[model samples]
Target: MYAIVEIAGHQFKVEKDQKVFVNRLATEEGKKVSFDNVLLIGDGDNVTLGAPAIDGAQVSAKVLKHLKGDKVIVFKKKRRKGYRVKNGHRQALSEIVIEGITASGAKKAAPKKETKKAEPKAEAKPAAKKAAPAKKATAKADDLKKIEGIGPKIASTLVEAGIATFADLAKAKPEAISEIIAGVRGNHVTDTWPKQAKLAAEGKWDELKKWQDELDGGKA
Candidate 1:
């Protein structure tokens, strides 16, 4: 029998006694961990698939060791900007051996019900009641990189200058927007930026997408 399970956001086809390396888990070495996010199981000709994940199904495994993967170099450069950055990264990983697979009847741990004594209600006076405090308005920041020709550097630059949302971008002038992103080291055009941002802020994705298709890197 073999089962497909999700461990640390990655899926794997595993069987009994199989060794697999996955994202680093918080479990200590030699400790057993059970994954309940089973997606599929197959035995001979019969197969069982989950609606996202099957309830009462689990895959048990024991952590063998932890290790780091090979270093990967990430390089970024901008033309004529004299800007270049390089970094190396190694993903932490854990090795585990599958112990067994339980086909059914695995129960999730239930939280203990707390028993609290009921308190007597206080009598309210007929005089008056205190007013509730008002909550401050919070603004949601949009992904400025979604705009055509707006890369990470330009997006961050705009954000640093308080143009963090699509609404703010929609209200900004082309010349002012250009000045805001001047330090980003790119000859970016912003004539259609406000229009695009207006469409995006209004949630007109289809219209924005069609307009972007006709645009040449945010130029008119």
Candidate 2:
């Protein structure tokens, strides 16, 4: 019998006693592990498929060893820009041997319950004069994409990082902005982002546009 199972974000067709190398797992060498994401099972002419993953179906394996894969070279160059970079990387991997396959037997793990702590109540104080009514709450967000060099994804990332408004972006440090979007694709220059945001927040559209015309993708 053979089964298709997902291990470490990758799928593999495995059978009893078959050894497979997969992405690095937290399991230590000589430890046993089980995969509950069994997609399909086949024995002779009969086959059992999962709607997504069959309930209670599991594939058991034993960790044999941990190792690194072959090295990969990455090279980058900019034509007529006197820029060149080269790097090498090796992927961590784990070797395991399939021990057994169960159609239905493994039990799902139970969820942990959260316990809230009780707080002590404070003593009541004398009442004071009432203040004026507070202003209505509204969700006001600035268009971060209006700043040159910021695309939809980068804008969303900045918003997630708490820089949602032009004022917020204007107060952000260039180093912090670079760190926030470090994982984003391509090279980005944030030297002019705060300057652009400052102009936009101050409602100087014409000046901001004029400055952007002199800039290149938010670079100085």
Clashing pairs in 2: none
Model 2 root-mean-square deviation: 18.4
lDDT of 1 by residue, 95-125 (tens): 9999998878432221211232221111111
Q: Global lDDT of each model? A: 0.74, 0.75
Clashing residue pairs for model 1 = none
The TM-score obtained by model 2 is 0.48
> Can you write out model 2's per-residue Cα lDDT over 93-194, one digit (the tens) per residue?
779999999997422221211132221111011011111111111146789999999999888777655577899899887776775665566789998999
**TM-score to true structure, per model:** 0.48, 0.48
Q: CA lDDT of 177 in candidate 1?
A: 73
After aligning candidate 1 to the native by TM-score, how far in Å is the CA of 185 from where it should be?
23
lDDT, candidate 1, equals: 0.74
